[model samples]
Target: MIYLDNAATTWPKPNQVTEAVAKSMKYYGANPGRSGHKMAIRTSEKVYECRELVADFFGLSNPANVVFTQNSTMALNFAIHGILKAGDHAICTVMDHNSVLRPLFAKSPDVDVSYLGADSEGVIDPSELEALIRPNTRLVAMTHVSNVCGTVTPVEDIAKVCRQHGILFLLDASQSAGIIDIDMQQMKIDLLAAPGHKALYGPMGTGLLCINTDFELAPIMQGGTGSYSKELTQPLELPDRLESGTLNLPGICGLAEGIRYINRIGIANIREHEAKLTAYLLDGLSRIKDINIIGKKNTLGRTGVVSFTHNSKDCVDISSYLSSNFSIATRSMYHCAYKAHEALGTSDGGTVRVSLGVFNTLSEIKILLYALKNMM
Candidate 1:
């Protein structure tokens, strides 16, 4: 099968990732940090190694600042709920996934929110953000890339505005974490969240939240953090402050191996390969008379995700045909960004999403194009 839905969750993860996860489950089944036994210590060390690797990959100064969660949604929830309080205002863009939008809306009824608009191509303007910023704006949460449209937001420019106003900047790097370069120090990002199942090539149930030491967020979950067993209150340290209960050691072990693989292969090389494949798909889809490609015409300002719609075919039908008849997997829907679809004028029916991964090749894209043409 030719899988093209890497944006949702990567498939055929790197062999190292699978091997590492299996090894952890089979060899070290002990709960990390719960005991001082050899097995427990070894498990704890592996988890810390994963944390350090994630910190290095994201250019974070300290590994302790990184907190592991179940997925990006959980990390986002922690950042949103922990940072904002009643009567505070936050700014976000329409291109954000529901993971970011829902929590902000669920804030105290007294809290205020501003949903900034994006262009037809799903690009958010820095000036638009500047105009929306208010004195009461405590945080500005936005995504690095639109999962539906594949449009890369101007994060650095937005970060500049947030820095100038002294507002907390929260970046949802769900789409761009492993593929794009993100520097926490340079971007002035106070909180960053991402899922390991996507570009990181890790197993599911692994996510990360990096909090800047200067900013303190309340703990969303409180329990025995292993550090403050005697105290009723949770520890106020970097990781133990947020990470409660036993972490997913097996998933984190795979995550560490995945980061190492990315480091060895180089992120730039992976970016180049995906960009070329996206460009090739765009060129091929553009040739079909009845097809309409979405987002930026070129792959310069986008990740490996490509979205398009055909004149006569329904989006769901196309995806079904691809999966059943052609054995080519694709995603068709709002992509969890209903507002983004409205902004891009695809509210009638969401576009077909073809997301390439590091393992994807030109040959797979060519086969997908041929399949699309045959369907047309």
Candidate 2:
């Protein structure tokens, strides 16, 4: 089966990732940082090793700044809820997923929230944010890439604006982690959150939040971090402050392997490969008389995600037909970016989303195009 719903979660994970997960469960199952036993020490070392790897991967210097979470949603929530106060104002884009929108919505009435509008092609301007910034603006939460349509955000430019205004920049890198080249320091990103499961090729339970700035974020959850056991209050240091309770050691091990896999292949190569496939898919879709490509109609400044709607067909119906008849998996509907769909005028029923992965090939895209044409 051709799996094209990678924006949701990547399938057919690399062999090393699965191997690492199983090996961790079998050999390194001890609770990390909780004890001084040899096994526990080994587990702790593995966890720290992953932390270092994540730091290096994102161009950060300190490994302790890396905080592990269940997924990107959790990481995003930790950033949103932990930073914004009652009187604080925050900024986000319409291209954000519900993960960002809902958390900010929960802070309504007390916190002032503003949404930066995107064009029909899902492009957002960094300059427009200046007008919306209030004196109390504390954070600017923006996605690195649109999950619904794969439109890349001008993060470096936005980061510059945020830095100039002393507003914290929170980047949701859920769809662009391993696929895009991100330098936290160079970009001046304050807080970056991403899932290890999607482009990172890790297990579903693995995610990470990388803190690059000195600004402190309050702990959303409190429990044992294997350190600071004497005090009832949470620790002041990073990672420990945000990450409470026993960690997901096995998943972290797998996530480390996933990053290793990306390093082995190089991010530029992965981006190039997916770009070719996305361009091919877009070109093919353009030839179909009834198809209307959504978002940026080309491959420039985007990931491998593409969404399109049929002039006469329901997006869900087309997705169902692909899965049933062609054994192809594709996502349909809002894709959790209702604001984006509203901007693109696809909110009525959304669009069929085709998200390519590192494993996808030209032939797979060819078959998908063929199936789409035949279905029409």
For each candidate in turn, the TM-score is 0.98, 0.99
Q: Pick the candidate with the highest lDDT.
A: 2
Q: Candidate 1 on 1-376: residue-level lDDT in tens?
A: 9999999999988999999999999877899988999999999889889989998888898999999999999999999999899889999989999999999999958679999898888888888888888889999999999998789997988988899999999999999988998888887788899999999989999999998747788998998777868899889997998999989999999999888988899899999999999999999999977889989879878888889998898999999999998899999989999999999989998999999999999999999988888884
Q: What overall lDDT goes with each candidate model?
A: 0.90, 0.94
| Per-residue error (Å), model 2, residue 188 | 0.4
Q: Please, what are the lDDT tens digits per residue for candidate 2 over residues 113-230?
A: 9999999989999889999998999999999899989999989999999999999999999999999999999999999999989999999998999999888899989999888799
Q: Say which candidate scores most in TM-score.
A: 2
Model 1: residues >4 Å from true position, as ranges?
none
Clashes per prediction?
0, 0
Clash pairs, candidate 2, are: none
lDDT for 282 in candidate 1 is 92
